[model samples]
Target: MSQDIHRITQATLDKLREEHHHLTTVGRTEIARVIEAARSLGDLSENGDYHAAKDEQGKMEARIRQIDTVIRNHEIVERDGEATEVSYASIVAVVYDG
Candidate 1:
């Protein structure tokens, strides 16, 4: 299987990196604390809070993995202000009519 590379601007890449760092560090810490608090309530099977926390954790982990993949398989494209051609990270206007 071939992996597709995502084309993004340097600023966008930087933002993604920052988000990944925050999610891995602060986000993970906060989630762990929430999970621990829910776990302390006892009765894991019927713990709604615990289940919700676990679901949130799963979603967060999926996002982290997605960010990781994008960070890994991305190309930083530079933006040009005076370019006539459209390139990666270029902004375009679209018109749709019936």
Candidate 2:
């Protein structure tokens, strides 16, 4: 039996790409600051700040890898040129009954 990968809409893909960029840039900078602060505390072995920063770095790297994988496998959905129809990048709000 083979499992099929779920198809993601273009809007969803864009959102994911944006989030990935944010993580790669802003998130990485913040983590660097944390590590710098920890280093300024003198010793790393006994520094809680250092440990926390390292953990956060690991998580950020993991998310970056996941996002890269998704992007690599992404299939861009084609859009119809009709104004009356909703397309891949169109934002539609629908009421949900849960």
Candidate 3:
């Protein structure tokens, strides 16, 4: 019962980390391309493409920042062999009454 540990399992963490890497790399590249295309459209003051690119850039950067914070604060939960009880990071299957 560690307080600082994440509620997700190691497998989920791995998947999230992989997605984070993909976002930080490929996402940034795509954003850059969008900005570049927008920039090539002449005047920045009245350019719709530029505004759209900026908006998308803002959202992408926000997501990147959120992912970075999550990685920084994440604590891995460990399970012991002798413990039969489930805790954080435990995957449970539930039966629904509904």
Candidate 4:
């Protein structure tokens, strides 16, 4: 079996890359710091702050992994093409007969 590939704009790819980098680095670092701080407060059995921080970290890590997969599996394509094809992003609405 072969994995399916998708096309993405360079801008989108760049944005996802930035998010992945920040999530893996800054996001993880900040969460770890928060966890450490919460741990310092003592009583892990009923530590709401610690649990919340851990939950947030899990969500962020999941997003990071998702973006990583997108960056790896998709191909970046230029959006400068002259295709006249209508897309959701380029759709315009005009009210006819007000």
Report the C-alpha lDDT of model 2 over 1-98, residue by residue, as the tens digit: 54335357787788889999999999999999989989999988899989999999999999998888778777776665555777665667799999
In candidate 3, what are the lDDT values of residues 1-98, reduced to their tens digit?
Answer: 33343455567668778878988899889989999999998999999999998999898888877766666667767666556777775556789998
Q: In candidate 1, which residue pairs clash?
A: none
Please provide TM-scores, in order, for all candidate models, with all chains considered together.
0.86, 0.70, 0.69, 0.80
lDDT of each: 0.92, 0.84, 0.78, 0.83
Candidate 3: lDDT over CA atoms? 0.78
Candidate 4 TM-score over all chains jointly: 0.80
lDDT for 25 (candidate 1): 98
25-62, model 1: which lDDT tens digit per residue? 99999999999999999999999999999999999999
Most accurate candidate by TM-score: 1
Q: List per-candidate RMSD values in Å.
A: 2.1, 4.8, 4.5, 2.6
Error of 2 at 94 (Å): 15
Ranking by lDDT: 1, 2, 4, 3
Better of 1 and 4 by lDDT: 1
Deviation from truth (RMSD, Å), model 3: 4.5
Q: Indicate the TM-score of model 2.
A: 0.70
Show the colliding residue pairs in model 2: none
